[model samples]
Target: METTEWFSEDQATFGDRVAGAREAAHLTQKQLAGKIGVKLTTLRGWEDDLTEPRANKLQMLAGLLGVSMTWLLTGQGEGPTEPTEGEISPGVSDILSQIRELRVQMQDNVKKMGQLERQLRAALKE
Candidate 1:
């Protein structure tokens, strides 16, 4: 069976890596832009490979996506991977699965908080 290499520096561009990481982190473009203090358009540009982020933004992006800057930029360090069955020890697999679940929960919580904030603002205006 064929397998997809999720991250390969030689095969994917920088923008591709960024987009992949962002998706893996469960962040929408707007959400990530807000966190990084950039405009939605700016983030789109980066993901589209039409432009590159400055150093500070790059650092922030790496942090927010839970990836190393080197990996995001060149796919040369810690990055996402999905090992096949038996590829990792059972304990390692369990830990990884737990971590993935926690990340999803965290992202969901962030979304819920944002919704509550918006609702509170609307209420305050009444």
Candidate 2:
């Protein structure tokens, strides 16, 4: 049987590790944020790679999610294992990859829009 590695440092980011661990722990973003004593937006930011948590919150997140801080930071230590065969169908996995790509594109568009809006406001003020 062939084994596939999941969430390797080269293949995944801190946000990906965080999301995977949170899901494996069966906690919603809101629930995890509450447990870690952070706002939902703050947790969302971390999961989206828009921002990172402070040291104390990072510790809390690692503990609550049952993953190592190193894994969360670098995907190099204790973390979720790869899914076994039939755990996720290829079709479903493809769909999930598409969704992640769309999310990244949307985030980029949002940043561009924010910059344009700022530029427009400055032009109006000129």
Candidate 3:
């Protein structure tokens, strides 16, 4: 029996699949990077084909991007039928991960904007 390479089902560039799924999910590289516990620059490198995502981040990337584990690594089929927030995509774990990520991003952006507004007001007052 031939041993499988885990992502053997997929044969395309992992970077392409990662970039595709991220786009399909309507997420930015930073968002996807944060979800997978990676740096935004790292995600950029992955998407730009400058470097490949490591084995560990691969599984997490697939989960966050709403794609099959194999497909994310290899280039499997037409890819998995990505489920929405409530649909049956992979498991509750991935969904929860995504939710938490989104919450963090929203909060961060809100705080950043608030700070920016304060700075702008100070500048206008001067």
Candidate 4:
């Protein structure tokens, strides 16, 4: 499947959508943050899924990036389209796709580990 379709809720997070849209719009992290009136680190956090934007910023991001708020949040509406062949080599695209999938898997593993730790603590207390 194309990288654009990979932004579905089950496959990607809000951060992923944000990053994809920003890239599609040809904006760098710094540029997008500046345009959205946020700090570069704040934008980084959003792209990394470590934090989220406030409503105002979210609105600004959606407007500036030309994507729907719903798509940014749930990946269920209009969002970034697939990059053209001229924009990226097939080999590079494949590598990026693999990297994104691995990132999602790593995030899931971290969540699972955290849950297991909490469960172990509760069991010990009981």
Candidate 5:
């Protein structure tokens, strides 16, 4: 069967941009699927442009891939320049800020996980 395109004249579908970015990151469908917590077949469907991701999933996917949500959702670049390493372009700065935020969140999650693990062990010992 012929696949219907999800986007219009001015807009690009969220799925296509996601698939392209994933490929650009040198990730396979299975790897992207694992990262996004989706099934491999579901990821393949997205890659084949079969359907769009839900709202929250889209945001999480964009965050995990380190691309701007605007670019991921609408294929529009947010006027940030691409620079070489340590060049500090405007876009790179924005990306770096996001990376720092993610790092903080990850550290918090690790601490929380450790606390939970300790509580579980203590309970089990009791």
Candidate 6:
């Protein structure tokens, strides 16, 4: 699955969505906070799901991120979709698909590595 689909609201936390949207918008945490008139810590909290924005702020955030407020809250409404380069050529699209596949494989490999490490440690302790 594409990274965008992998990180769908169903699979990701509110903070994860926020971070993803922020990155898609090409804004840093500090910059987003500044644009939204919040402190960096507050933005961090939102992105970490430690806190949520109020209604007004949420509206502002949705607008700034070019997504719907509902999407931000539930990922059900209009949220950021995978960006398509202007008239994506076939070659570029194919490469993008391959990249997504590689990313999934990488994630699986990482998980397997972690499991192996844990097993190794347990065996060494025996």
Best by TM-score: 4
TM-score of each: 0.61, 0.69, 0.50, 0.78, 0.49, 0.62
The order by descending TM-score is: 4, 2, 6, 1, 3, 5
lDDT of 2 by residue, 89-121 (tens): 888677766656665677789999999999999
Which is the better candidate, 2 or 4, if ranked by lDDT?
4
Which digits, one per residue and each the tens of the lDDT, describe model 1 over residues 30-63?
9999999999999999988899999999999999
Worst 10-residue lDDT window, candidate 1? 1-10
lDDT of 6 by residue, 4-83 (tens): 34344545567877887898889999999999999999999999889999999999999999888878888777777666
Give per-model CA RMSD.
13.0, 5.6, 14.4, 2.7, 16.5, 5.2
Worst 10 residues of 2 by lDDT: 1-10
Model 3 C-alpha lDDT per residue in residues 75-123, reported as the tens digit of each score: 7654645445454345654664565556557768999999999999999
Q: Candidates ranked by lDDT, best first? A: 4, 2, 6, 1, 3, 5
Displacement of the residue 54 alpha carbon in candidate 1, Å: 0.7
Clash count of each predicted structure: 0, 0, 4, 0, 0, 0
Per-residue accuracy of model 4 over 1-126 as CA lDDT, tens digit each: 346444547877898899989988999999999988889999999999999999999999999999999999998888877666687877887887787778778989999999999999999999
Any idea what lDDT model 2 has? Answer: 0.82
Better of 1 and 3 by TM-score: 1
> What is the Cα-based lDDT of residue 40 in candidate 2?
95
Q: Model 3 clash pairs? A: 10-74, 10-75, 10-76, 11-75
The lDDT for every candidate, in the order shown, is 0.79, 0.82, 0.68, 0.86, 0.65, 0.81
